[model samples]
Target: MSSSRILLASRCATEDEISELVFKLQALLPERRRQHLRRVSRDEVLEEVCSYIRKLHKQVDDTSERISQLLASADLDADVLRSLLQQ
Candidate 1:
């Protein structure tokens, strides 16, 4: 399918918030119908894939940062508990 069509399918998907456009498109049509679908250039597909990867990477980085902060807080709490026990 064309890049624009895939992107639109992603936006239009109502069954799952995290559904991939390609999967949605595949589920929408039979193989025969799919064969007639317009094909997107490799460059356009590559650009879309790269953009998605970057978005996923950012999400992972943000989650990692939040986990680090939680761990640091837990360490501080542990220290406070240790001091109280010593007293």
Candidate 2:
């Protein structure tokens, strides 16, 4: 094959791989989030993923804080608390 044709083929393969990955990412998102968007672009997929990640992080932080407060109020022994946390 000529050099130009080889380059074109390689580029097409790369684009296809990227498109497949984006589709997979979109699939991983929640149904409600995906329902509103039709014919989304790559940038929109990335934005949704970022938003989902941020929401998850916030939930983790909130849960951790609540657990700490409950442990403190209970006045549990240090060893017991540590073991509970490990579990």
Candidate 3:
């Protein structure tokens, strides 16, 4: 039996984890939907691109916070915000 899928963001994935994300994206889209996306109008393309970027940003932010919590749990010294704010 085919499993039903729920659409949701994987917030734990880091910015560097996009390779894995592309594989999931390809899996999520059906063939006809993929084909339509490929041949979509300029407005639709831009909107979809913007949506993807926003989702990526959300994923990256979530990953950052999770990493911070892990570091604190391990009693390690690290400040991701400090580094980002530094440069």
Candidate 4:
């Protein structure tokens, strides 16, 4: 049940690729052995999760920058808002 002891050879995968690979791999397992399979599959799972997390982090950063850009372009500064409200 515990998967921490699992170790796997290092491999490279992009997040989308990892997701597809995990889905395909898990789907190939028998229903009765999926639990054990996960344990046995720890190496691949860990690799995929790591890749996905990194991709998510990059997306989060990019989204934050985009929001800042939008706010700047929209002239949403507090001082500008205050001036507009006064008029």
The residue pairs that clash in candidate 2, if any, are none
Report the number of the highest-lDDT candidate. 2
Q: What is the lDDT of candidate 1?
A: 0.61
Ranking by TM-score: 2, 3, 4, 1
Candidate 4 residue-wise lDDT, 1-87, digit = tens: 234323221345655676677767665555654455564454765565566567779999999898677767785779976775589
Which digits, one per residue and each the tens of the lDDT, describe model 3 over residues 53-81? Answer: 78889999999898778666764344864
> How many clashes in each candidate?
0, 0, 0, 0
Residue 53, candidate 4: Cα error in Å is 0.3
- Estimate TM-scores for all models: 0.42, 0.70, 0.46, 0.42
Q: What is the C-alpha lDDT of each candidate?
A: 0.61, 0.86, 0.59, 0.63
Instruction: Show model 3 residue runs off by greater than 4 Å.
Output: 1-34, 77-87
Q: Lowest-scoring 10 consecutive residues by lDDT in candidate 2?
A: 9-18
Candidate 1 per-residue lDDT, tens place, 11-40, comes to 875435434555454445546544544375
Most TM-score-accurate candidate: 2
Residue pairs with clashing backbones, model 1: none
Clashes of 4: 0
Alpha-carbon runs more than 4 Å astray in model 2: 1-13, 77-87
Question: Which residue pairs does candidate 4 place in steric collision?
Answer: none
Worst 10 residues of 1 by lDDT: 18-27
Sequence-dependent TM-score of model 1: 0.42
